[model samples]
Target: MKQLQAELHMAMLMITHDLGIVANMADEVVVMYHGRVMEAGSLDDIFRDPRHPYLRALMRAVPRFNMAPGERLTPIREARASTEHLISGAARPHVAHAHDGPLLTVRGLTKRFTTRRTSWFGAKPGGEVLAVDDVSLEVRRGECLGLVGESGCGKTTTAKMIMRAMRPDAGEIVFNEQGVPRDVLALEGDDLFAYRRKVQFVFQDPFSSLNPRMTAYDIISEPLVIHRIGDADERFARVKELMGLVGLDIRFLRRYPHSFSGGQRQRIGIARALALSPELLLCDEPVSALDVSVQAQVLNLLLDLQDALSLTYILISHNLAVVNYLADRIAVMCAGRIVEVASYDELFRNPVHPYTRALFAAVPDPDLDRKLDFAALMEGKASNPAAWPQPFCLDGSVKLPLLDVGDGHLVRASADADVSELRA
Candidate 1:
């Protein structure tokens, strides 16, 4: 695009939420919020010395490679859930203190699709699509774990299986329910209904996930109504409190989903998911679709809510930067299997697997002088399991285990691969 622009000598007006792209391509920058331009200046002037508080906050919220190991992002307007509205009755689950055990556990979880199989003259049957393959994961209590990968990498599929939104072809999902480990996959009837109240999902698309026919109030209170937990008056009060909790105004409760902006609609989704006060929140790409400034607000809101409520989140996203900002531990998936799992600092400090390194290489560096590696991206060999270098390589005859190199950091490699080789 830069080549074309230079060749044609044309002025390109590129509008996007990616600050890295803006830093790399733009000579001038314009910061806007709520249909108004807050500031406009040269790229260096705007980024290096921002005048507007909103712009400054937006930049602070973005995850940068140069940021310190355990630094937190500063959101524009921090919002926390109000726990004072907790109804002392059957509606609320018995709140328990977070223990050392995992809040959720998944083992050998696999899902496959075989409907696309076809055979000519019944000679041979097509193999099924292994959407998820022998995946195992553990979510520590009160901590955010990120499931990250490119689209079609089975990140969302794994989350769906964990939430029981879809059934897995094989494997087990276990939840530590009030200090008792329960097999989540075997749950049925009222047990399943009770489980639903314990785990809630916040979807990727705010617009599509919500029903246009329903108003914000109806959407937020739908869970409460379905469970038959609170009376009309109680539900109404809860809805109003939820609106305030998510930074939405009570006046907008009667408005339909179409009337709300992208961020507002997402707030409604978050509020709806929180209606049951679930201990686990499966947030699938919660902030990817929103604008940059709005993304900051939502990310901060999730952080604040987690701190206030002791919520455990399984945040799924393709953006490494977003995950970097929010996740305590990140699991990197490629094709259908997890390639790496490590602490936020360890993963960023040293990404061991080829697929993991490829993902890092693909991330658009915020540094204006550092250009993207189109050659590595175009080759795409690193992400292909069959083409991975050395002991990391996989083929039909070989399946490797995720061996821990050190300090709980796992990397999927062949049996012969040693820690020194991986570190090298």
Candidate 2:
């Protein structure tokens, strides 16, 4: 779309949650919140020096690769209702990890799909698509593991397999409960129900994920009701407790999803996910549908919840900034395979994969001194395995493996490539 606009010399009005897209494609920016324009200026002015309180919070909420250690995200608190006491008391339930092992491990995961072509006459068989290909990773206890990629890169498919929403064609998914390893794919009947209770999902779209017919109270308490955990009174109390945790007002319990703002609706979703008291949370672009100011609030709330509940998260997103803000480690996926996996800091400091480098290069830096290099972008060609340099390129004949590049960082390169050559 960007290429088409550029080639046609067309002026496009783009609406997106991705600041990187703004930096790359937009000349002017208008930041909005609560149906009001918070700030408006040229791209440089908006990103480099935001003046509005909401705008500033939004800027801070976005994760930058060059950020220093111990930096914290500052979410907008002016619009939020007071619930400090509720938050403080909500930190009671803590799940202990066995030693320091990963809470979840996914190995050799693969999924395939066959597309059929439809014509005026009839439907014809089409080629097979590799949605996910032999992907493996681990989610450490109480830490966020971010899965990042461009669209159609299988990030969401991988998350679905982990949630067991869809069965994988091949692979093993293990959830380590304390010390015992449970095969997620092999479970059935009551065990699967129990697993669902231990792991919950937060969808990306707030409006569609929620049912407009259901009140906030019913929406949140539905999970509890399904599980048959508590009686009517007890479920109502739990719903109220959840509302407080997500910073929603108790009075809004009677209101429908349509009555609330996008951020509030997301909070309600989080509250619903928490109803089961899951140890692991799979957030599929939870904040992508929200406004900039609201995005900060939601991100901050997720952080707080993770800290308080000792929750482990598998956050799937295309936004590098969002993932960098929350993830302890990151995995870069391309062509339905993981090309790079590294610590949050390591990946940014030194990205080995060509695709990974292209992703970082595309991100618009807020600093005035550092501007995006349009020529360096290569018009998105870096994503193609065929376009990569010698050792990194993967053809059908050559076998490539994820090689350890020291300090626990790994990069997928040709097995024949020497460590020195791979480093280069």
Candidate 3:
């Protein structure tokens, strides 16, 4: 889309969550929040030195590979220290201590969809599409595991299976609750209901995820009402507590979702998710729809809630920067399978897979000193699995496996690839 705009000599008004796209493609940038322009300036001026607080927060929220280890992102609204009390009684049992192994383990998960093809004259059966193919990964207790890939890469599909919103054709989803492994797929009735209480999801779009007719209080309290966790009085208290926890004014509880901004709506969603105090939070591109400034506030709220609640997160997003900001480890998916899994720093510093390298190359560096590699990008061979060099390439007949490089880092490559030779 960007290239076509440039080639035609057309003025492009691009709207995107990707700061990389903005940095690389935009000559002038306008930052907006709640349908109002917060700041406007040249690309260099906006990125190099942001003047507005919202703009500054937006810049800080973006995860740069060059950041020092342990650098913390500054949220727009800094959470209050006293908000910890909101989560005191709401936390689920057996989540306080760090487990010896993974909190949730998915093994050989596979999901295929068969579509029916329809023509003008007639309809016929379509071939099966493998949405998620033999994918396996683990999410440790009290840590955020990022699942990243382009659209149609199966990140969201995998998350849905984990949430049990959709059942997989094959594989095991093991939930290790205090060393007791419960098979998620095998659960029924009360067991399934209990599992749902232990896990909750925050959706991608705040606007659509919420009900327009429902007030903020009704939306957040609906979960508690469904679960029958507490009486009306207790649920009302919980709702107010949740509002405070997410940095919202309690007075707005009676206001409908349409009255709130995108960020505020998302906060209401987060509060709703926390009503049951689930141990595992599956956030599907939670901040992708918000403005850059609002994105920081939501991201920071998630971090603060994670710490206060001891929550484990499986965050699925296409934005590597957002993943880098929150994820302790990241799994890069391609063609319905994970191609690489590594710690944030390790993956950024030494991306081994061709696709992983391609993704890193695509991220635009905000620094004035560092420019994008147009030559490398123009090649465009890295994303094509067929174009990868030997040991990384997989012909139709080759049996490729996810091999361990070292230090817990894993990469999918040909079975014949020398593991030691591939170590960075």
Candidate 4:
């Protein structure tokens, strides 16, 4: 299109929600919200001199390669969830579980696929494949742990095991509730029900995650109905409260999922996830399928909800930018194993793991002068751990372990691997 426009001397009006594409390809931009055009100008004028507050908010929300330390994205607006029909102390202040140990812990977590059917899930075919290869991680209360990796890196598989949607072949998941530890894999009957009430999952595709036939009200209140938490009147009122909480209008409660926009549908899914008032949420690429602008809204909503409900989160995604924006700590997965774990600031500033550095290199920058380095990225050979150099290589004898170089930054490397070299 650019070539044609240059050769034929044509003017094109490009409509997109991807700010990166707009920055690279567009000569002019029109900022619109709620069916109204708020600003229109040249790309330079629009980006450099965003006069409208909405436009400024949108700019702030765009995922970027260069961000100052601890600089948070400013959401366009916040949706405050009311506590009218909620449980007692629903709106209490967030209490960090730092001193209480981890809220959830996974030890020796492993899952294998026997047949040739599931090889596409980051596994070599014609043999037993380890989809989740001896993974272990922890989540603390009121903190967001971002599980980030490339596609088919077992991020979702780990999340599924945590959610108990799929049975893991081996591993013990311990749920620590108020100083008491319960084996998650051995949960039965009422124990399972109790466990389910404490954890909920939000899926990637909002449309598929929701029942197309069910109305918004029914969808949001289904968990309540199933749990027998409240009567019809009480549930309806609760549904209304949840809808408002997610910034959805209660007037649309009678409408089906298809009638709502992508962002709205995701909000509905979030509201449904909150119906049971779960303590932890497993968000599997929740905003990946939405528009860029909408992604900002949903990310902000998640943060707002976390603060209001004191929620713990395991946000799974391939997008590092999203993870950087929301995560307190980040765990990097590569080819079904955790390669690194560290606070957001530490990981971004000084990535010790080879794969983590490669991931950062792969990220597309919106800066005009800073083009993507395809050569270095291809040479990184990030998919195959066996191809890595020296101590980072996973050859026959180079067993890797999570070694701390400095300040709780864990990187998987050979025991004898020089931590100083990796840190540098």
Residue-wise C-alpha lDDT for candidate 3, range 177-209, written one tens digit per residue: 678899999999999999998999999999999
Instruction: Put down candidate 4 lDDT per residue, 96-165, tens digits, no spaces.
Output: 6567889999998999877654555764455766789889898888899999999888989898889888
lDDT of each: 0.84, 0.84, 0.84, 0.84
Lowest-sum lDDT 10-residue window in model 4: 85-94
Better of 2 and 3 by TM-score: 3
Full candidate order by TM-score, most accurate first: 3, 2, 1, 4
lDDT per residue as tens, model 2, 1-424: 7679879989889987656557667789998778998889998888778899876766676666666776766665633533455445533455665584888999999999999999997999989999999999998888899999998999889999999999999999999876889999999999999999989999999999999999999999999989998899888888888888888999999999999999999999999999988889999999888876578788878887887777889998888878998899999999899999999888988888889888877777654455677666667798888888878997764558899887778899977668665555
Off by over 4 Å in 1: 2-13, 27-46, 50-57, 76-100, 115-127, 369-378
Which of candidates 1 and 4 reaches a greater TM-score? Answer: 1
For model 1, residues 1-424, the per-residue Cα lDDT tens digits are 8879999999999897778788878899998888999999998898778899877777786777677866777666665545444454323433547454888889999998775444566545567778998899999888899999899989888989988889999999999987889999999999999999989999999989999999999999999999997899999988888787788989997999999988889999999998988899999999988876678778877877786667899999988888988899999998889989999889988899988888877877666655566666637676678888777887874778998989999999987787876865
Candidate 3 TM-score over all chains jointly: 0.90
lDDT score, candidate 3, position 316? 89
Higher TM-score: candidate 1 or 2? 2
- Residue 122, model 2, lDDT: 95
